[model samples]
Target: MTAMQRLAGFVLVLGFCIIFLFKDGRSQGNLLTGKTVYVWDFATRDGEVNSLTGNFTEEFEEALIQTQQCIVIERRKHQRLFEQRQNEKGIMSLDEISNAEKESLKSLHTNIVVFGDIYDDTEAGQLRIGISVQSFEGEILTKTSVLMPRGKKLDAESRQMAMKELVQKLVSGKDPRPSSEPIVVEVENVRFELKSCKLSGGNLVCTVVITNQGEDRELHIYLPNTRIIDSDAEEYLVKAATIGASAGSAKLVSGVPVKAILTFGTVA
Candidate 1:
């Protein structure tokens, strides 16, 4: 049976839930830039893997290797690592990544991640392929979408052309934080703006900005109750927190914004 077929059966046995591990990795045209990348199996909109998606993903990885720019992690060789995140869809936005899964990726020693989907194109004889590339720091560096001949499956030359554009983009493009979309929360005028959440020195550090709109009432930030929650519904209690020169229990004034760094212990 094909990899897709086996994965389909495996997914069915697990109630059809598809999960993945993602971390930082990267590009093309250079002789093995020593950057690590992982290409996931492409899937249909309904989350089913098919020959078209499978072939395209495999071909793209081969193309990337040919350019001698990246070390593509063969998924078959790391099946257990891919199985680490056991209850997530195979494809999702970068923001949905959880802390535990990020830790898994770190363990995998990856630097770049590539995933894509196949959609019906506007034209009659083509399929729309949308691919996204993300860095280890949870940033979506760039994305590309192209139409391929329907049922033809791209030949070696066409696949090379496709990966060449993406590799060039990665090589030339500076990784950007497309995933950091201003995660803001408010509770009775205490606006908390999460600037970024990332792994640093084996701990999860989340930088947040707190705005006190309490009209000059001393904004009380009770550090003992703060927690860093992940997309997986798992909560990591803040082991250390700080604001400016203060290490813990920092207060804010009305209309003044104070930056707080909340640190959590390693999820592993």
Candidate 2:
């Protein structure tokens, strides 16, 4: 064989070997090596845990572990590390950790941080737990919430089921529910006059009148994250609904008002 043919054969073999190595490395990397997730102890909005908060955290960690997709840093471990860091910094209490410090902690070599709060819904006789998973940079990746109905006692089974659902949704990256929080922006000379808001069969129906108090101007309303807080301070997530008037494309003349009906769903 000619020297050129031998050289071409060697080059072809080298290219095939390189491609094989690259493909193998990519497959190995894609395997479930377990993402490092840290679960912070959930705070209770109504005073203390009352035992439910602690158990919920454990269940959350267990769910992640069972998925074989996460290496969970349990609450106890996280507490110890937090305390150690506080001691090193001469901080006396966990409350002393500023928001910036907390954000820094969440970003510390962790792939995901799961944190949230539990609220006692006194009127409904239930416990509302809101869980959010965030990236190291503090961007929320997914949020799932659950409500455990309380009869005469705390329903442990219901809580477990909620945790399982949350974990499954988190792993699957599907959120059927809308956001619980609202994105509020202040527009000069434009005001929202809430007409009426009522909860009817697990949904909150609300009507608001938007007025252009200053000058004639075109206005757009995008309220994907809009929420309604009841008299009891319970908040519901707003669902997408058609407003009778085109709120998103309303051209309001001076002193004119546009009435829009808004609907929100109860977060479970």
Candidate 3:
């Protein structure tokens, strides 16, 4: 065989080896796997209603177990480990849980932690529970909320339904919060200003100022109805809008300006 033919054969073999290694590395890097989850006790809004949170946590753990999507760590084992750390470090509260302590807990091979707050919605005559699930790296994976009829007697069936919904939402990777960020859209007789913007998790959050120049009138702005147009004529839909803590709708009165935070989820 000619020397050129041998050179060509060597190059072909080298190319095959490189391609095989690249494909192998890509597959190993992108493997999707189940995570080990640790569910902690939920805290009450008033800090006085312990039983409410306890019951909710119990139901939540049970629902998570039934999903068979995660390896749920036992509450007792988690409590013992937490208490051992607290005693050793003189930590008083989980809020005071340091990065070192977090790393130590990660050593247990638990990848996800779920915890939340239970609020007494007295006005609505219901109990509002807000739950957040985070990764061991402290990144919030999802937030969930459940409302149950408030009464002297706890509703077991309602609690079960709520827990099941939360678990299903988590496993499905759906966020209850609005997914779109707010951007200033140019409208006739209206002035739109962007004050600040930030990327939080998978959402773009922005603080904006809106001013109406016309006569005394009420201007209703639906954030989700708004669209962001790029230089390339690509339109991005706004998923959610909020003013202060209140979300969904915002009212702009004539001669009165309003500043509100808007969140937009990244285009999937």
Best by lDDT: 1
Worst 10-residue lDDT window for candidate 2 reads 23-32
Please report how far candidate 2 places residue 68 from its true position, in Å.
1.3
Off by over 4 Å in 1: 1-33, 83-89, 93-104, 122-124, 154-160, 177-194, 197-254, 258-268
Q: Candidate 3 lDDT, tens digit per residue, 1-268?
A: 4555334323322232233223322222111137687776666643443666678888989998998866888776557556544223222123345666576567778777776667677898987666656555544444557567787328788888888987775666533222234334444455565555444543545566767676543333344445543222334455676653456434456767877665656421
Deviation in angstroms for 34 in model 3?
Answer: 0.3
Residues 1-268 of candidate 2: C-alpha lDDT, one tens digit per residue: 4555334323322232233223322221212236677776565653344466677778777887888876776656556446544323222122334666566565555676676567778899887677755555433344556666766225677667877886775676532222333312224666555444333432445555666687776544344434544323456555643334563345668787666565667422
How far does residue 203 in candidate 1 sit from its true spot (Å)? 24
Error of 1 at 196 (Å): 3.4
Ranking by lDDT: 1, 3, 2
lDDT digits (tens) for residues 88-180 of candidate 1? 444533345567666767788988777677776546977666666656765444555666676555576765566566556555444334232
The CA lDDT of each predicted structure is 0.57, 0.53, 0.56
